[model samples]
Target: GESVGLHLPTLSVQEGDNSIINCAYSNSASDYFIWYKQESGKGPQFIIDIRSNMDKRQGQRVTVLLNKTVKHLSLQIAATQPGDSAVYFCAETPGGGGNKLTFGTGTQLKVEL
Candidate 1:
């Protein structure tokens, strides 16, 4: 399985820094991509997304870079904060049919004061 799973249950970082989250995908044919952030106990909220047609996409305070050449993707969060602490998950939509999201490994983000 090419699914991405988190190796760590939590990550603690200082505020006003940067955060980098990693994920692994399974399907080699997946085309669409998305990064979601979930608060303490809330549903994942859409942060940013990119299509297979592009290599990178940027949003306010966040940037997603895709390396189709290596079948890898990463999320970069700028200015870490206590409120920024949450679980992040990456999702991909495999090509071929209806747009369905396949989730990858999740990383727990914790911002320390």
Candidate 2:
């Protein structure tokens, strides 16, 4: 058996407030990044993704921002609700033909009423 999530960061937000999650990657050559959200007893679900060539990408109620020079990525959720409570993380893949992806430490998001 493998340990998927032994350690995680945490974010607390009100039901109607927006939530911002931040992640930092170490791979300078990495060219692809994705954000995943996992609910209790569920697998990681794809939230959004951005490529190194892009600075920002937006989705339905969600946005992913990438800063390549600083290796920083952020997920912004608009009007976060209780249903948004979950664990979130970011994954980055290396450049060229590399298929390996590095995942950041998970973050637990708690929605308060």
Clashes of each: 3, 0
Off by more than 4 A, model 2:
1-8
**Pairs of residues clashing in candidate 2:** none
- For candidate 2, what is the TM-score? 0.90
The true-versus-predicted C-alpha distance at residue 78 of model 2, in Å, is 0.4
Tens-digit lDDT track for model 2 on 1-113? Answer: 21122133888999889999988877787889899999999999999999899999999999999987867888999999999999998988877776777787789999999
Q: Rate the local accuracy (lDDT) of all candidates.
A: 0.83, 0.85
How does residue 5 of candidate 2 score in lDDT? 27
Model 2, backbone clash pairs (residues 3+ apart or across chains), number:
0
Q: What is the lDDT of residue 72 in candidate 2?
A: 82
Candidate 1 structure, TM-score to reference: 0.90
